[model samples]
Target: MSGKFLPTARFLLIVSLLSSALAVTPSAGAQAEPALQTHDVPVAGGPSGEAAQRLADRLGRSHTAGIYLDRTEHRFVITATDERTAEAVENAGAIPRRVTYDTAYLDSIKKRLDTNFKTPGTMWGIDVLANRVVVRADSTVGKKDFAALKKFLAPYGSAARVIRVGGKTERTSSAINGGDYIENGVVSCSYGFTVRKKTDPTYKAILTAGHCTITSGTDWRKSDGTYIGYTTGHNFSNGNDFGLIRAYNSSVTYYGNVEAEGGTAQDISYSRDSRLYETVCASGYKSKYACNSVGLKNQTINYTDGSQVTGMDVAFICRDHGDSGGPLFAGDAALGLLSGSNNSACYSYYQPVNEALAWYGMEVF
Candidate 1:
């Protein structure tokens, strides 16, 4: 059931059905079955996004503030801190613009805040387009805490920006569950992509949100309480939120497909870092599947539960309870996992899938 077998399996199934139909003497009274024709699935994330990622990889994160697609022109626009880096970007066939701060500097600012001002109900992320670190405090932040955060960030001047939004942040795991949801006895959460160890192909695991596996050693099950897997590795603190689950039955087949719109399934090819403003799709137990654009990257989110997850990205998509650990992808590329969302659930924050894959030495199957 892995990716290697998907196309072949489909082909064989089609052939078998056709053979069966041919063998059947179509009685004049029997309505003919509708013709079966496979239509090509559309791929997401065009060349513009891939080109920016390649340049960003070559230039490194230190000198590059951000790289995104110019929607109007459909070209890659890269922001570089120094003239030398800008020249390098130009030479690489991208449009380079000068910016005051590099991603490294913005990351440093985030670190400073992470160390000193980890106020709950607040989150911050680098805005590469604005060339500044944008700090956001949701409605849960009291006036006093907001003032304290503002005062602390005052020294950074324009390098740091702060704003307020209208919702509280919360993980989407649910206690009340029905349907085919995955559960860890305590809370129910959505399942993510299936992955295999890079070094050991026989070892398989399921990727999910760290908060879902925060209680390490917990056994996961299906809604009916059947055994599914167990938490092997989970990271819910220090601005990270991803977890791994070793499959209970290693010999069982697991496909690389995710439920897409209209009850269809899309095969996941690989994982990659997300580009700002690029549209991606998410699938979960609650929300099913939906597509939306990326809002920000390298974000630090401080949940109202006194927990924090850094290196998150914000999306314009909406999610519901039990959507935690869902998959966010574009085309066949796995991007991130559902982390949490604001109180109103208007937008979502996710942990990049590549980060979890790297940390656990795994790849999507």
Candidate 2:
């Protein structure tokens, strides 16, 4: 988004999910709690701090998010709506920490965005709100620099005092402009590390959804920007978008639709998406909260502006694009693949990550 400072549903959803089953409710043995203002706590947006950083990236500044600060640890937190955003924030030199938010707050944010900001810049359904900071072009303002834009936003919100976020401009036509830059936009794939398929020290070839492919001719690699393999096969625009390319020499690994908490792993991978009813969780790159999940799996899903999305896919409390190809596990069984979500750009959907693997002859952990 160009410039806008507004909270969103992404905040509430993440807060609800994290504060719910995840955060260890202040234990009985915990220290006495202090009296607090339920509404005044300065809550940062999203679970991952990427939202803030992305805004900064676009604005050409540094803004960190995910501050779980209080009396205990005074350190700032960064929440990336997805793994890539998380990585980007970290790479950009911000201190990142995973986080979530309250549902009521999220609900209120949605209502607020409608009421506030007469004009929005862009909408990604994440940390940053998409509203225009400059209503008049009296003085030329370039979209490339946010510092000037932040000056415009200071009156509404503390652009300086608050966390900043980064954003990427939409890529223009690469097909027609035949300049000499070597080529095509990259189709990338990133998968949640599977547990079953990996050991402590050995490198494992992880499987991922194929829609994320950069095409068959390109090679695949780790997020660190190293080559690992290539797209041997892929499918997209349907219940497809799966791909398989084994590690050149590493052992293939698997991860059940579950997660590791402290010392325990929960099996979240659903065998049949048709039966999904209860609140399911999803994660994506809002550039704010890293892996933010929302409750309530909405039915009658839509896409690309209310186009009906067919078949059964998983929906979480919240998530977004850039989080695509991420794993969507129910407990520890590897449920689905993070595809697209209907709830604006803030939420996301996933194909069965395991199924994508299976089609390519890759095994799930």
The list of candidate 2 runs beyond 4 A from truth reads 1-185, 193-205, 214-217, 249-275, 283-302, 305-309, 342-346, 353-358
lDDT of 2 at 186: 61
Give RMSD to native, each candidate. Answer: 13.8, 17.7
Backbone clash total for model 2 is 97
TM-score for each model = 0.81, 0.38
The local lDDT score (0 to 100) that residue 267 gets in candidate 1 is 90
Query: How well is each residue in 178-235 modelled by candidate 2, as lDDT tens digits?
Result: 2111111364334543422323323334445454553434565444444555555556
Question: Which ten-residue region of model 1 has the weakest summed lDDT?
Answer: 34-43
Q: For each candidate, what is the lDDT?
A: 0.74, 0.35
Candidate with the greatest TM-score versus the true structure: 1
